[model samples]
Target: MPAPKISVIVPAFNHEAYVVDALNSVLGQSLGDLELIVIDDASRDGTWDAIQSIRDPRLRALRHEHNRGAHATLNEGLGLASGDFLAILNSDDAFHPERLARMVAALDSDARLAFSGVDFIDSDSQPAPGHERALDYASACARCAGQPPASWLLTSNLAITTSNFVFPRSLFQRIGGFSELRYTHDWEWALRASTDTPPLWLPEPLVRYRVHPSNTLAEDDVWRHIHENAYIQTLALGGSLDGLDAEGACTALLHNTSLPPLATLCFGIAARRLADDTALRALTRPGPDGWFLRQLAQATGLNDGVFRSARQLADQQSALGAQQCLIDERWATIQQMSGIIAERDAALQAQAELIEERAQAMAHMSAEIAHRDEAITAQGRLLEERFAAMEEMGREIHARDQIVSEQSAVIARLMATPWNRLRRFVTKLRH
Candidate 1:
């Protein structure tokens, strides 16, 4: 087939969960004349297998035998492009179905533009939190009519990713591929490209930029992030600000004010003394100027840099105060919770003491009852002995009555007989 309209290069690392979706987003675009070149950067996960599962004729899957960084992988993918316009998508990020169509139309509107970009969505394809800052910058760019796109880019990396790129392949070959910076290579390239051909910003969220724990900028080393960013920004300042009149230079310089003191000084130094790259590089290194630079960098952030614009500095201070207030409120809430827990524990302790006292009382009552039961048993035995003695007395009285009756009958018999009366009289005398 002939060369495609666009060549989208996807550099996959460990995005097995997301690579297929990223590829599908490209292949299933409404603008269907594009070729999808996916390079798996020797991902340890199932990213390579996921790429292989895609069977579209427009998709070509490539793999790296060994691991390489994102910069090298992107450069290699760009080298194999066979289309008029070149684009890049990170393996973990996806595009809207209509993104390419809209971006292509934007690129066609201005021949002088290097590339076109849109706002981004978060991982779940929702509006990314704090994305308003990026939108505000875009809105500011729009409001600042006739401002050099290069100068505005110098302010911040509003495009934010190579995934946002949809530029001419020729420009990629001319300006360069990507830099070797670990963190901000996409930004470095954007700065490099904007200086020559300017970038076009589309205000719609056409791409899903995954903000996650494993993001590429997820570096715990504070120094490296600051150091690498300062390095690129300083170098960017050197030649990128040339040919600007007083207004343009001032615009660019003002843009650099929001940067740290090290980067701010670099912009000033590079503007005046950019002949030797070594001198600009030496400003950030540890040497005669190191202590002062460290102090300023460590001092109050941009607050120490009186060179910064007053409005932006005040804004930073205001933001810092707000953050401190929030921290105080959160601390107060935690203390309140702790107090409640302590009170609950005290109440529980009191209940336990009461239960122990009740148990002791019950034990004492049980002992008294046992003693009373023993005395009652002894009294019952005495009553039983008395009843037995009364029964024996009753038997003795009955026997005496029987004997008296028998004696009376014998006397009656004797009286009835001729000698009975004489016998009775004899018995009475004997008694």
Candidate 2:
């Protein structure tokens, strides 16, 4: 019964869709001398079933009867892990094939380096945009080359997330494992661990971190994360900040403006707790602190003139943003009104064209009616002339008939007269 070279811890909750892929990535690693420890934190989904389906001897699956948080699950896995080195793989995230091999090699080569670099991937298991390559660990370290390890870590968590961390198991015992936190446990652990031994930077994308809607570091949890970060900073600093060399630490932190706002605020809190007025002044003297930092300052009773100035600046920025929003709305309304006016103009133009067409049609119809009226008048005159000619013919016919009747009567009278006897006597004598 020998311990594996590496112990991979997976804190799965509701990652049934991706848990298989995550498990496969770990079990299929090129370096086979590793044990996979998956703790199901009472997932309501089929994540537990998926974990059980994997039939590997090196795989150790644990289940919580109740829904324990991720931190508890991790702590349990750490306690049960039987390996020389430790690695964490979120159930929703996966690793490249060579991730375990590469990270182990990096840790083996350097005793002081706690972990290697990481790469981000999207939900589709593809490399995230702007994260095509592994993080520029060398450049980051080079930026803090001469600074103390504590100062560098206080400024930034060189290893971005737990998924990117693969350290010697002994280091966990030295640092007392992860703290009990709802959020920011990984960050807190990194802050503490890196302060002791700086992490080694492996400039290759070994892990595939999945970013999706269900990610724990969602925007809505920002405040919670900030609160936890401040708490962790306080714990790290203990009751006093004397050991941190507040002046030097503040200078180092301020030099890197790229540090997250939360980390900077944490430094401010530490300085305020220590009553290092000079450090506090230096930290907040950069014109204006952001709204969150200002709130932190006020909470810690560090609201001096510097804080007031920052509050005023924040108020001004907020007012400007409101004014800009109003301007945009007004501009949009004007554009909409302009569009409406243009549509009305077009409609009016169409109506005008229609009116013109109707007028032309009416004019043509009137001309046609006039032409028809003239034709009717000419026909009426022709009918009157024809009637007059017929009347004249009728009169002529009547006169002729009267004349014939009179002529017939006269012929009859003459025949009955004496001519008849005289003519007849003469004719007989001649015959």
Candidate 3:
């Protein structure tokens, strides 16, 4: 059988709810000459059943005898891809209808271009405002124009998601397909593919990444492992982590909910170790040292709230090594103070309890005290009722405040319309 122009490999596992969207996304692309290969990795759920329901001749669904991981499934799909070009689409991720059309054109125009990619949709499947720059070619080209070739996209949105990229089959083969490594495998693949050849960059969030409840990174344990694995891969690649600060930021974001204080500290140390590797000295020169410091601070639990604590400790310790040395000191102080405070406070609380008991004993003999106690109890009940009412009132007030704020913003916007139009006209006249 003749190979198609492009082969899109999709690895699906228990993504029944989203598989159809993924399949329809590929099948509905503007580009033709596309072959869709879906490898169902022994999904016990309705994932394979969903694939069976799709009747497109171009799509070939392969099933495994038993469940394998995403890496194994992806490699299996790779073996089945016969097109001159290769692309990967996760089961939960979809592409904009024109994604393939644009990337394929870029690859065809430049024989040396090993790959091309677009931006990914945020977790909500909506284009993220912060990363929207990757969705426009003009902006991407402009960003890359004056930068050194090696420094091209070193820090920012240079790499594209696996679902968003398309690469030549030869290049994919030469790189030996996807590595077994998890988390940063896509990033590693992107780096390797762009090693000798410059990959075309398409700025656009054509790939819609689904952030569902069952995401691997959602669990604390999984996220930590993924971040550590990514850092390990960065070290293994001989890639200078002068970008460690940026990576640390991404790490913090990825595992913010899951990572404990200690885990974050460890991740920061691991990141610093990566940055300090001798092999990466060339990549991280003098200019990025400040970034390293900032990253080190973040990793050491020095958030804005904790910065003062860090600063206070720095007065006693060296400002440079203060963060690391302060951890033990801080822990010791916290423990010692907590124990001492607990013991003293417990004794004082007991004394206060005895005094209260004596007061109650004396109060029991006085009829006036008994009447006052009843009045106080009634007041307490009234306070409890008032508190509940106030809570409800607070919620209503908050809702009303939000509505008022939104209305005010709308009014402010409308009020500026004439001024904005006048300014625009004046600007045009001046030009």
Candidate 4:
């Protein structure tokens, strides 16, 4: 089979929940004439299972028995690419369906463009928050008419990720693959590749960049990232100035980032060792001491070490002042919180008093109800006794009526007899 148009390299790790969607995003892209190579970097989770579950003819699955870092894995994937164009998709991130198409068209249009990049989405697959300042900075640089792409990139990184990169395989061969910096590798690569011309910066978001606890930026090696950024800053603004106008780039960088003096910004890379190469180089004549910085330290009756010590002391004093300000703010907050607590306690006390009053009223009502209940019970007993007496009287009346009826019947029978009739006639003649 002929080689695909693009070779998409995915360096996978422990992202079980997200790996499948990432692969699906690649396979389901609008531009389908691309090959996808996923190298599982010895993930402990079910990320391999998720990657394996994808059934596609364009996919080539690979696995690492031991976990190599991201840069190494990417280089390995790069070696296996057969396509003219190359793209990288981080395991936890997804792609816009039309990303490859848009990027390819831009690259085909301009040969001088280092790569093609677009805006990105966050973990929710929407425009990320808290990036307004960075976005504004990049947008402002891009809007500067007649400026070279390198000048636009001198202030801040435009295309933020290797995941955002879509360039020719030949460019990858020239500038090489990712560096060892876990946090700022993408930024370093962005600066290195864009030294001549700017990448195609499409303002529209075409990729989902995942930001979570597991990101390389969230790693514990903060000093390493700082050192890496120091080197990267050196590449852009350090000794050689990386083919940029030194005065203009330095002013813009300082204005944009509010960074320290040129010497400190270039040399004071916060790596673990204080006497590292970069720091020592700052003491050289051409670095911080040459141009505007003469033997002013000796003029002030202090050597270079003493001058450095004085600067350190001043920095400590400033830090202490900041700490004091924070403490004062916290004390004010504590006072405000105390006031709120006092009001809450007062309200609770009022509620307690109201509850006590209600309890007393309820007790009084209960007693009154008991008293009424007792009275009603007594009246009920009296009515029951009266009813019993009336029933006895009715029985006696009934016996008397029966006796009178019997007596009347006997008298009527005597008057109806013949002897009674003759006696009545003799009594009438005598009268």
Candidate 5:
């Protein structure tokens, strides 16, 4: 008998509900030159009995004395694997029928390519809201250009699950086995491997990563998520202060641990110094139900930032109003000049009529003079009333001008305060 070309390793620990589905997915793979190794990490459940139910001769099963975590169990499975290639699949997740076949074909096609796999289901295992089902390779290239192929091996949709995708045994040994990371060791492994040789990516979404309550990435594991994500950012950025620019890196670091209320409070403010809005949003959105980001909002006067942007937008609008006012003032001045010219023309016409009447009505001079005097008196009273109304209107305009000037000054003062200083003050107060 010859050794199998590929060994699919599954580290099982009380995954009775989903482990069988995961195993069956492998057994059904189009590539049959494979061995399935299920190492039960001292599960208290009927995991052992469950393994006994499977009668495949190629299936090799083992048991641990106590519950070793996935990292340890995976390393043990690697030692037991007899094939040239290693595939790691979690007990709760599974592969599509063509996953093993496609991955093997890809690795066989390129010598430099150590591993190859497809996009798996996302964290929800459903299409993201507003996104269509069946995202092709072209769409993926557009989403994350220049990112590693294995990054898309999201644990839900597809993973280099110890079972589905195969990797060269030599490369696995060179990079060292999976670290004893609490939650994010797989991401760390992918990042480390890509530094030397990038994994070959197949654009198909061939892995069905299951989303269930029993999974390790459940929302309740906030501390674990924070710790793992923080460590991962450190590794990804090569320990540079500039490395914090890696999206969601700083906020994950700041909020992951069970810091004192004040310490966590202060760090939340510090997270906002990240000039990237996308990173900021990621930082605020917490693990699982996004509780951490909410906590971040409450801790750091994040509403203040929101208010500031709103106020600035308002000031810009006010400035636009002022510009319009200036245009209106110019228009009013033109109207006043036109009104003066019309009033002068009317007065001249009235004077000409008075002179013609005086010459024509000399015989009835007394009666004509009396009528002309009455007309002049009425015109004088009308002019006096118009002058008084114009004076009152000027006073009202002056009061409104003062109010606008004061409001504009206040806005300018608020805009002058440095945002950085304000954030630092908030952090200090929280600390």
Candidate 6:
């Protein structure tokens, strides 16, 4: 039998609900010269049975006794693939009828191009919003003007999903194979595989990336993904990830909640380092960061509230730090004022002691003055008593002198008369 033009690898796990749809989408492709290889990685569900039910000459269903993982299963499929071109379609996703034809035509036109473009769809098989435009070949060529293909891919993955990738088998062999990682294996593989060969961009939505409840990318897993991406970036920077098989590296970077700025910077740098000119030009084009964030939010099917919560958390941290600084400053000021008050108290205590000593000296002087004033008052009272006794003696003397004068005058008058002289002699005998 002639070898098929393309070999489609479908890695099936616990996708019993969607595996049939995935297989039907590939079988219904307009391009019939293709081989389908579905690998069941020890699914606990009926996925193996569903894959077994399909009986087509091109269909090759393989199973693992013990679950290895998606990456291992993909490696197995790659080892068995015998087509000119290789493609991957996740069990949970489906492809459009013209996907293979369109991608094959694009690759055939340019032997240098490694892969083609991708499209997205919801779990209900409905067309994803904002991605309705078909791939514009001319515009894409013009945009990547003057830039190498490998450099363009390093900047941004034009092949948005692994399901959208349809590259030459030769390119896959040259770049080695997919790296074994739990999360971001596709991204890592793309980075390594497209380092030299640039991929083609098919703007049309060729693959329906179902956004369902069972999607592997959960909110809690974002940190792990970011860390894994950082590690991948490190490997790329050190040139160690070129063809290295990074098995279980995914387990090391887990349990993180948010993407740190450093990690984000590293991721950007890694992308630029790996980007071709086309990717760099597309990235340099004028656009808002919000638009990119919104695209991510839409692709992840997460609500805007999650981002708001992160913003609020960051604002709260900033406010808390500012408040802590103010508190520290106020505490220092209080300490300074307490020291000043202590010094003032010490000076006031010294002044109070001096004033007390002066008061004691003044009290001693007042006591001495009071004792001298008491002695002077006693002397003044004694002099007043003596002066009163002298006044009484003087009064008695004057009365006696006046009596003598009267007696003398009477005697003179008696001498003039004998009768007066006899009366005077009788008064003297009576005295």
Q: Which candidate ranks first by TM-score, i.e. highest?
A: 1
TM-score, cand. 1 vs. native: 0.61
List TM-score per model, in order: 0.61, 0.58, 0.51, 0.59, 0.50, 0.53
Model 6 lDDT, residue 353, Cα = 93
Give Cα-based local distance difference scores for all models: 0.73, 0.71, 0.64, 0.70, 0.62, 0.66
For model 4 the TM-score comes to 0.59
Ranking by TM-score: 1, 4, 2, 6, 3, 5
Note each model's CA RMSD in angstroms.
Answer: 9.2, 9.9, 38.3, 14.3, 36.9, 19.7
Compared with the true structure, what per-residue lDDT tens digits does model 3 show for residues 60-162? 9899988877767877888888998888888888878888877777778454333344444454566554553333333544555554433343323344446
lDDT of 6 by residue, 195-217 (tens): 54445665665777776667776
Query: Candidate 2, after superposition: displacement of residue 294 in Å?
Result: 11
Question: lDDT tens digits, residues 149-173, model 5?
Answer: 3333221122333343467777677
Clashes of each: 2, 0, 5, 0, 14, 13
Query: In lDDT terms, which candidate is top?
Result: 1
Model with the higher TM-score, candidate 4 or 6: 4
Better candidate number, 2 or 6, judged by TM-score: 2
- Candidates 3 and 5: which is better by lDDT? 3
Residue 207 error, candidate 2, Å? 0.8
Model 1: residues with Cα > 4 Å off, grouped in runs: 109-119, 129-148, 239-258, 266-431
Please provide, for model 4 over 1-431, each residue's C-alpha lDDT reduced to its tens digit, 9 standing for 90 to 100.
88899899999999897888888889999999999999999999999999989899899999999999898999999889999888999998888899888888878845333333344456555565456433654565454334545555555555566787787888778887776656666776776666555567765667777766677766775334333544555555532334457676765464433122433443444323455644542333234444212354446665333322223446667999999999999999999999999999999999999999999999999999999999999999998998998899889888888888887888888887999888898899899
What TM-score does structure 5 among the candidates reach? 0.50
Candidate 2 lDDT over residue span 288-380, tens digit each: 554445566677787332322222446667999999999999999999999999999999999999999999999999999999999999999
Candidate 1, residue 18: lDDT: 83
| Model 6 CA RMSD to the hidden true structure, in angstroms | 19.7
Deviation in Å, model 3, residue 159 alpha carbon:
3.7
